[model samples]
Target: MSTPEVSGALAPGTHSTGAHSTVTAPPEASTFRRWTSRCGWALAVAVPLWLAVGRLLTDSAGSLTPVYAATLAPTLLVLSLVALAVPARRPSGYPSSRACGILLISWGCGIVLGFTLPDVGEGASSVLGSWAGPGFEGAAAALSNPLGIIMLFMAVLGCVVSVRHSAHGDGSGRPRDTEEDEAQGTGYFPVLDV
Candidate 1:
């Protein structure tokens, strides 16, 4: 008798071979992602201002100005508005978990550096004071006065940017499963059906 034609599925011996196929779903952006993206954009804008106007606020050589500090919020506001205008995009092909882990590491490193770095002049004076008693306190005062503020701002901004970039999504700040592997059921490999 001829082997009953196994029609419904592939035959036991014969292989149903064809070109491999893959399915990819469009990425979806979330509100939180968008917010973070916007923050990133804002932070980008702030970088320049921090370098220019913000610098003036701390530099005694530049006529330490209260007005400069007052202008900071407005500058930040402008940056925020600019960021909001730009829509967030999903990351090209990065895994969210990996990105998050990297961000955490960067944040941790930044925290450690921020705490350990001697805050410019302050660090030097503090070192001197340890050896020569309180005479060097004035030299170290810069750390507590202006340098400390700038350092704090830098540390905070650096952490924010690191966290924002590490998180998935496009420039617009949305989480996207752009990686081929992520779309597939496998955590790190693209699913292929033959």
Candidate 2:
């Protein structure tokens, strides 16, 4: 009897009952990749533009310069996203939940790093409020934007979300990395039945 086309893998010694075999269906891909790609592209463009704006505005002393840390923070996230492009260069081929997870964490780290850097004059530390304090904005005053604020929120949220999500996950709401059984021979992509 001809075997059935299975979408999920059949148990060992379990044969399809005449064209009724269960084919193991590969797990669904993640949507996080979508957000990752979007965020990366956005930061890549926005960060540079903002940096330029910061330089232009801060041409003179006490002219409202952007926080150095802010520029540095988004740059790290942009680079990470550029490399991963929503988990992997090709989203459909492989779901790099772990890579994506790491990138998310990196994004959060970048945010913290940005804040840690000096927020005063060129190479000045803001920990002591180099300029004056809240009363003294300093030459390199912090710049704010709707996009930037959103990005910051996203960074924190990404970190929180990644606690459960992982690269090996099927994104089908199943336990993460349990799809080792889903992996086939060869590279990162799961082997599809031809």
| Candidate with best lDDT | 2
lDDT against the true structure, per candidate, is: 0.37, 0.43
**Residue by residue across 1-194, what tens digits does model 1's lDDT show?**
78765455543434444543333333544544444444445454554344334323333213322333354334433434332332223242222222323333333332222222221332232333444455654654443345434434543443344344434333323443546336654454234210
- Residue runs of model 1 more than 4 Å from their true location after superposition: 1-22, 55-194
The TM-score leader among the candidates is 2
Local distance difference test, candidate 2: 0.43
Judge candidate 1 at residue 188 and give its lDDT: 41
Kindly provide the TM-score of model 1 when superposed on the true structure, using C-alpha atoms: 0.29
